[model samples]
Target chain A: MTGSLTLRAGLLSCILLTAFLVVWHLATRGAGVAVEMDPEYAALMGATATQGVSAMPGPLEVGATLWRHLRDPFYVNGTNDMGVGIQIAYSIARVGIGYLLAVAVAVPVGFLIGMSPLMSRALDPFIQVMKPISPLAWMPLALYTIKDSGLSAIFVIFICSLWPMLVNTAFGVASVRKEWLNVARTLEVGPLRRAFLVILPAAAPTILTGMRISIGIAWLVIVAAEMLVGGTGIGYFVWNEWNNLSITNVITAILVIGVIGMILDQMLARLARLVTFPE
Target chain B: MTTPRFISMEGIARRYPAPGGGRTTIFEDLWLPVQRGEFVCVIGHSGCGKTTVLNILAGLDSPSEGTVIVDGQAISGPSLDRAVIFQGHALLPWRSVLGNVTFAVRSRWPDKPREWVEAQARRFIALVGLAGAERKRPAELSGGMKQRVGIARALSIEPKILLMDEPFSALDALTRGTLQDEVRRICLDTGQTTFMITHDVDEAMYLADRIVLMTNGPGACIAEIVENPLPRERDRTDLHRHPHYYTLRNHLLDFLVTRSRTFRDSPPPGYDRRHPPVVRPGAAPQPVPVPETGDTLPLAQFANRRHP
Candidate 1:
């Protein structure tokens, strides 16, 4: 039954994709009536002015461009021109570094807050105040202080990724079953061992959930951060493509960004499943 | 006469600040002592603070106004000498049965080699009849099986005292009976000093050498300690066939149903907090002094048949 359901879902997806492509093909098939115009002006007027083709690239055009990029994804020609793979790699690198740094800082701090009521109460106000602010809101301050666009983008990813992990870790740790804690106490497990063996394992699934959320937010924020900083990354690639009037590349970058985000989310999801217990 | 008891709770009291003001005393001036190998059960209704008493004994909790001396030394915190089997069967769900037991064994003896630790764990797993299920996680196991892992984990530590907080209360009747039998057998064989809290009268009768009865709270206290008259070797199947079975059963039931409530208003003629009266129901018949007599009067008459 599950297999048939999956097969039906796949078949529906294919039908949707086919219908979308056919509509796109039909919409972009016609051109405006040929109009008398000077050659030089016609060249500058572009397709929208000289012809009736939609400004939106047809499915075929986007697919061809996608195929080309995939074929040679990692090539680099100049400062302004690089392969699609290179752009994605840059975005991933920034997100990875920032996200990892956030993990290193947030998890320990979260544990402290979770384990100690004093720290939890003391840190709660600061966290509450900072958590809702947009990641891009920090871009100006980061760029001003860091004086480096790439590093500023990384800092924004770090900030955006911090809260979900920190809050989840703290909540998970604080709410660990009292019975389990009591078990640890009766066993006379020491502070360090108890934290590592009991508390860490118990809170791991929650912590991983936080990580998944952080990675998603980090992926989203990195794009906007890159656009603002105007350097490397898929966000810059999209903006650069837009400036060059290449909607195909922009669409391609969007698709790639989505796929990467899903992959990152799934990676953390798998990790979460690994740590989850039946009880 | 001068020798310290195996486990002595001296003047222990538990209180929490009341909502409006002052304090609500759950129990006060509680005192009890156990011999080296005795199995003791504390029986009380909900809100009677029986589990709190067990927690204090385990050193997972502290009494407001007293100390617990275990084996000639004061216990300030949870010690390896005491292990608790939590009511929820608090096995680390992430760990397999073996891993759970090994965790406790390793904690109890950190310097022991890995093989030695595992061997000790496996031995206890076998003792609890969970040897083949060592690789199974707590979630993969049935309720009874999960509790078996809990038992294995607690026993693997080989503590000086085994503390249980209604460990079998969560299981079905058949499972509870079987687990009770297993626990009874293990305790008897090892002579491991055990203290448990339960509301089940039969459980107290079957396992406890002496059952400590508590009155209802905001100020609960040990009303009496009933000594078990049945031989320790008695079987669970034909337990009722024993001569003293109904006498013991009826006495506990009577105390729980009626005497537990009114005992606080008017304790017997001579009641002591430090040393609650120890009664043996089957031994003799003794009338307890009551200020008011009615239908509830006869139950109290046979219930506290003090043996001293």
Candidate 2:
């Protein structure tokens, strides 16, 4: 039954894609109206000078541009003309470093807060005030203090990713089953061993859930951060293409951003599954 | 002969502050003792603080007013010397049956090699009749199987006292009976000191050498300690046919059904708080012989005839 359902769903997706392509082709197809103008002026008009073609590129045009980008994805023609792969690679690296730094700081702090009610209460007000502010809101301060736009962008990703993970780890560690803690106590397991053996395993699934959330938010914030900082990232590629009025390149960058975001989310999803246990 | 007290609770009282002003006493001025290698069960209704007493003995909880001395040392907190079998089984769901048992074994003997820990855990698992289920997680095991894992884990620790709080109360009747039999056999063979709390009178009779009965609470106390009259080798199937079975069963039933509620208001004359009276209900002036054939006398009539 599931196999048949999957086949039908695939068929429907094919039909939808075909319909969308057909509509796009028809809309962008230029009317053949011959305008009586001087040869020099007509040459300056570029695609508009053709008998009846619209200036807007159709799906066919976008597909050709996407094919060219894929063919030479890592070409570095100049500072502003790097290939799509290089741009995406730069974005991914920034997100990776920022997210790892967040995990290093958040998890241990989260553990301290979760394990102690006094710490949880004391830090709660600070976390509440800091959590809801946008990562972009910190851009001016980050740029001024760090004096490096690239590092500031990475710092934004870190700040955006930290709260979900910290909150989740704290909540998970705090709510570990009382009976399991009692078992450790009765066994006379020392505090450090008990944390690793009993509390860690018991709270693992929750901690992973928090990490998954943080990774997704980090990926999302990295794009906007890169656009603001404007060095070498998929988000900057889209903005640069828009400035050049290359609509096809802008559309291609959007598609690449979506695919990479999905892959990043899927990676974290698999990690979450690895830590989950049947209860 | 005076038996040396392997464990003793001196003037233990557990109380919680009431909602408005004063404290609510769950139980107060309670004293009890267990000789080495003895099986004792505390029987009482809900709210009687039977579990509190057991927790105090296990060093998992502190009494508001007294100390629990085990092997001549006052216990301040949980120790490796006492192992508890929780009512919920409380097996770490992520751990396999052998893993759960080995965790305790490793905790008790951190210097032991991996193979030695595995061997020790395997022995206890096999003893609990869970030999073939060593790799199964708690989620994969049945309720009875999970509880067997709990038993194996507790036993592998080699505690000086095994503290159980209604360990079999969650199982079905058949499973409870089988586990009880397993427990009785293991305790008898090893002469392990055990203190258990249960509401099941039949379970108390089948396993305990002495059953401690508590009156109902807000301030419960040890009402009496009744010595089990049946031989240690008594069979569960024919337990009813034993000469003093009905007398002992009815005495426990009467206390739970009626006396536990009123014992607090009207204390028995000259009842000592520190040394609760030990009663042998079936030991009347005239001895009753073991029934040879099918004796069909009703339980109430049999109890009255012997005790009266």
Give the number of the best model, judged by DockQ: 1
> Model 1 over residues B170-206: C-alpha lDDT tens digits?
8999999999999999999999999999999999999
Model 2 chain B poorest ten-residue lDDT run: B294-303
Task: At residue B214, give the lDDT of candidate 2.
Answer: 97
The residue-by-residue lDDT of candidate 2 on B1-308, one tens digit each, is 13556787778999999999999999999878789999999999999999899888877889999777787678899999999999999999988998899999999999999999999999999999999999998999989999999999999999999999999999999999999999999999999999999999999999999999999998999988888889888899999999999999999999999999999889788777766778887785222232443232222223334432
In candidate 2, stretches whose alpha carbon ends up further than 4 angstroms from where it belongs are A1-8, A31-56, B285-308
Candidate 1 ranges beyond 4 A from true positions:
A1-3, A31-51, B2-4, B285-308
TM-score of chain B of each: 0.91, 0.91
Candidate 1 displacement at residue A155 in angstroms: 1.1
Among these predicted structures, which one has the highest TM-score?
Answer: 1
Best-performing candidate as measured by lDDT: 2
Share of the reference A-B contacts seen in candidate 2: 0.91
DockQ category of candidate 1: medium
lDDT of 2 by residue, A1-279 (tens): 556988999999999999999999998887765787777777787656655676678999899999999999999999899999999999999999999999999999999999999999999999999999999999999999999999999899999999999999999999999999999999999999998989888888898888888888888888788889997998799889999999989988888888998898898889888777787
